[model samples]
Target: MLKIVVLVSGGGTNLQAVIDGVKDGTISNTEIAGVISNNKNAYALERAKENGIPELCVSPKDYDSRELFNEKFLEAVDSFEPDLIVLAGFLVVIPAAMIEKYRNRMINIHPSLIPSFCGKGYYGLKVHEAALSRGVKVVGATVHFVDEGTDTGPIILQKAVEVEAGDTPKILQRRVMEQAEWKILPRAIDLIANGKVTVRDNRTIIAE
Candidate 1:
């Protein structure tokens, strides 16, 4: 079984999707070893507890300094000995050392199609708001490797969702999450766990 550690900072809707996928056998041969969060009050931790998955909180506020927090966070993640790390709506910026160590072993779900309404300051509902302001007819989500730069990693899977007429940011956010993010994030993890995904020269090549 592939052991995975999921990182989250919010309600963990994406994390719940992965859990459901595993239970339904959509993501076969995988075990969610643990769930980590920066917020102790995050509902994701409660989800993990309810599911009997190991959970930890490594909040920056708990540490005396940023460096200390990073170290503790890394230690917390390593304790699970995860084969894969899933960033499912995790808000913390990953430490460079951890990214270098994990490399392609870590993946994240982004709220936008990427290369547009992505990168810095473009997370959560902000991404959808930007797409609406740009008047783009299409909005979507991306599953990508976590690189040193924000949302600049090799793409693994993308699903486009149409921006319907008179859609507000909140409405579009829900649509994109349901149509795109919820599906592809688990699919990407399944592909990776099954050895069907490969990264080459900063690009992803999925096998049949």
Candidate 2:
């Protein structure tokens, strides 16, 4: 079985989606080994506890520098010995060392189609706000490998959602989540866990 470790920093809605997918047979051949959060009070920790998965809380503030925190963070995550690391609403930049070690072994779900409304400063409602401000006719979600560059990883899967005229940031955020992120993230996880995805030349080739 593929063992997965999830990183989160919020209510864990995406984390829940993965859990539900695993439970409902939508995602198979995977076990969520653990969940790690930077926020001690993050509800994601509660979700992990409820599911009987090992949970770890490591605050960046505890460390004097981002470098130190990165070391500790990588150590904590590697302790679980996960075959795959899923960044589900994890709201921080992963350390370069960790990214280098993990390589294609880690993945993240971004709330935009990527290459547009992605990269630094394009997260949470800001992505939707930017899309709306740009008067985009469509918005979507992307699941990609976590690379050294922000959101510039090889795309594993993408699902687009229409942007309605009257959509506010919050409303658009919910729509994208329901229509895209919730679906493709688990699907991408399943693909990777099942060995249906291959990375080559900084791109992904999904096997048929």
Best by TM-score: 1
Question: Candidate 2 lDDT, tens digit per residue, 123-150?
Answer: 8999999999999999999999998999
Lowest-scoring 10 consecutive residues by lDDT in candidate 2? 91-100
What are the per-residue Cα lDDT tens digits for candidate 1 across 2-80?
9999999999999999999999999888999999999999999999999999998999998899999999899999999
* Residue pairs clashing, model 2: none
**Candidate 2 whole-model C-alpha lDDT, 0 to 1:** 0.93
lDDT of each: 0.94, 0.93
Measured by lDDT, the strongest candidate is: 1
